[model samples]
Every structure is written in structure tokens, then in C-alpha cells.
Target: MENRVEFYRMSKTSNPKILNRITEQILKAGFSGNIKVYDLGLDDEASMSLIVEGTYENEDCCVAVGYGMNRQNLAIRKKWFRHAP
Candidate 1:
């Protein structure tokens, strides 16, 4: 995939659910990869996302947690990619 981060969100669900949903998507799609979770903690006020990524059927797919910031809807997109392996 290209060297850019696309926009995607998973239905505005609770934190861990985001990861769970993403995992299912990737797995069902026949993609194998790791989940890169960024947790700065709520105490730090650092907004981070739990990311699930992999290459599915030769296409790059990624899912991230989002509470809104980029104006995109809270849902998943097959176009999203993070250059993940």
C-alpha cells in the first residue's frame, strides 16, 4: 500500500470492542497481522486508538478506534491502510 494513513472508525463502540470488531473484520477477510494498540491512558488525556491491520486478499485493511476528530463517520472502511505488514 501507499505511505499514508487513511481514515476509518468502528461504529463508535466502547474501547476494547473496537479492537474486537477490528480483529473479526481482518480475520474473516483472511488477513493475518498484529494489533497495534496505542494507550497513553485517560489520565494523560492522550487520545489514542487501538489499531487492527493486515493485508486481506492483496488489499490493505485497517480499523481504528475513533471518537471523532476528523469528521469521518464512526465506521469501518476497506480503503484504510497504515502500511502495516
Candidate 2:
């Protein structure tokens, strides 16, 4: 099966601590492969949006990550979407 890519929008704080925390959370939730967390510029609310891409064992894992991030105040832009590249 192909790897799944998920997207999320977080507060405009892209500090190393935040990035590391996100990466750690994803990995702890059973995500595999390299995880990339970068700012995708600003959103409509003027808050900095972040794009988190990684491979997971299943969609449920992604959902769990999203919820976890949400609890941390990261708004999930979309869940379980395909990334064309």
C-alpha cells in the first residue's frame, strides 16, 4: 500500500521545540518513515500554517495524531488526504 500523507495547521510558532514535540508525538503514535514539519506560510486567520507529512501504519494512526495535535492547539486542516507529487 502507498504511504499516507496528512496535513495540519499549527500556530505560527515553528520553533525547534514545537517541531520536535510534533515529530515525537507522531512517532509515538506509530508513524513510520521520515516526518517533515514545515511552515506553509499563513492561513486565512493570519496564523502560520504547518504541513506535517509522514508515513503511518494506517489511517487510524493519522487520525490519532491529528487529535493529539489538536489537543495541543494545532488545527487540523484536513485528515487523511492524498498528496500529489
Candidate 3:
């Protein structure tokens, strides 16, 4: 998962089209369905986890997609998450 993020980031060297293609491939590996992209953030140093209020399969499939994005963000951009101005 994390590796995908790195690849996604590195893809900037190639082109946006290639990055989008790679993203599509990652999503297709899982069952096509609703996916919510969320951010894990902190408030005053308090930790909070993203909650998905719905049913999910235990196949590690959907989670894998999320794991890739989240893991990568945490690994490479832990301190650069978005903040409202």
C-alpha cells in the first residue's frame, strides 16, 4: 500500500496521465464500490482515527487500498497534511 503512494508520488516525474492510470489499477484490484477518502489528523496533539460507518469485507482488499494511501502519506508527508487557513 505505502509503496503505491511512493510510486504515485514518483510518477510526477513521468506524467499525470501515468499517475492516474496507476491509481485506477490500484482501485480496480478491489471490488468496485463506494470508497471514502479521509484524512487522519490531530487536534492539540490528540490522535484520532478515521471511521467508516458501514460494512466492509474482511478480505483485506478495501483496507489494502486505504492502507496504501494512508501508509504512504504517513511515511512521506506526515508533517505536510492539509490545514485550513
Best by lDDT: 2
Cα deviation of 60 in candidate 1 (Å)? 6.5
The most accurate candidate by TM-score is: 2
lDDT of 3 by residue, 1-85 (tens): 2223324223112456644553454344432344333333321222222222111332322232222332322111221222345
After superposing candidate 2 on the true structure, give the runs of residues whose Cα lies further than 4 Å from its correct spot: 1-11, 38-50, 58-85
What TM-score, to 2 decimals, does candidate 1 have?
Answer: 0.30
Worst 10-residue lDDT window, candidate 1: 39-48
Q: Which pairs of residues collide in model 1?
A: 9-75, 11-74
TM-score (C-alpha, index-matched) for candidate 3: 0.26
Angstrom error at residue 78, model 3: 25
TM values, all candidates: 0.30, 0.43, 0.26
